[model samples]
Target: MAYAADFYIQENIIGYTGDSQNKPTVYFRSGHKFGRITQAYPDSNYQGRSLVREYTDYSISNRPPKGTAEEYYNGEVRHCSRYPFIPVDDNDSLKAVLAIAIASYPYKKPIYSK
Candidate 1:
């Protein structure tokens, strides 16, 4: 189950990630249940646990302090965080989720296209 879930996540990150004004955002299972990390606080670090929240009504202008937009997949709300990735288990050994978060994060732009 873990491997399948991880593969699914990876496939989504690669094939289904969306862009808003060229800003990258990740969608879980091709739905609006997605995340677009705007800015990381000065002390923000993906390597550490941070307070994460969920929001039903979200917008850039009318923003809240924490939490990410709710993502629904397989008939459940997919858990999300301010951190880069959602851990599949207690030990996120490979940090695959972090890689997805980085890919979807809007901090840097790609230099060239292949």
Candidate 2:
């Protein structure tokens, strides 16, 4: 399952980290580097590290909890009655998730290399 963090790269690329806790292998995206996937875990070395992808199925025994922040955000997205970006066709999940990633970040800035 792709979380909002999966859209960190370009619109077409997904910075895929599988459904387990492994250091995300390093890669470049939009002139920045991304790899460390758990900035939220309190590693002092990860200056400017993006928080780990918090969205995951509860059934995944090894994955982190889908934190309240994401739950609330998604709740806002799904429960809100005024959402116009909710698509009605194929790739609807993709478009909706990408829309969340793109428009939700602070001033639309992405998580970049430290």
Candidate 3:
């Protein structure tokens, strides 16, 4: 499975959800730096550090009991619901993808520089 963090870099997507549709908007850039992924309401005015905190919170599993924030964000990414950059044909496929991402997170090997 691809590392969950790599999804951003692989897709090269950057934007917040659209105000009305909640559909994601794409503002393309040549490259991207993978960071945290989390939910931010369309109306929310999320600052840089706030976004970072959300990402960290999601990463550490400090989200709602209903589900982890990271999972929800990943679902959005997986489905291309909020963001159209990632393509997924159905919810089942997204779920399977999420399961793999979650399963892979804890066991991911660390990269060490030579």
Instruction: Name model 1 segments beyond 4 Å from true.
Output: 1-5, 8-10, 13-23, 29-68, 72-114
lDDT of each: 0.32, 0.27, 0.27
| Candidate 2 residue-wise lDDT, 70-90, digit = tens | 112222331111111111233
TM-score of each: 0.20, 0.21, 0.20
lDDT of 1 by residue, 1-114 (tens): 121232224433321122322333333321333333332334334221112223443222211454333444444555443323232232444335434554444232222111
The runs of at least 3 residues in candidate 3 whose Cα sits more than 4 Å from the true structure, single-residue gaps closed, are 1-10, 14-21, 24-32, 35-44, 47-64, 71-114
Best by lDDT: 1
Candidate 3 least-lDDT 10 residues? 47-56
Q: Against the hidden true structure, what lDDT does model 2 obtain?
A: 0.27
- Candidates ranked by TM-score: 2, 1, 3
What is the C-alpha lDDT profile of model 3 across 11-60, one tens digit per residue? 33333323312222212122222332223334433211111112221211
lDDT of 1 at 6: 28
Q: After superposition, how far is residue 58 of candidate 3 from its true place, in Å?
A: 9.9
- In Å, residue 61's CA in model 2 sits off its true spot by 21
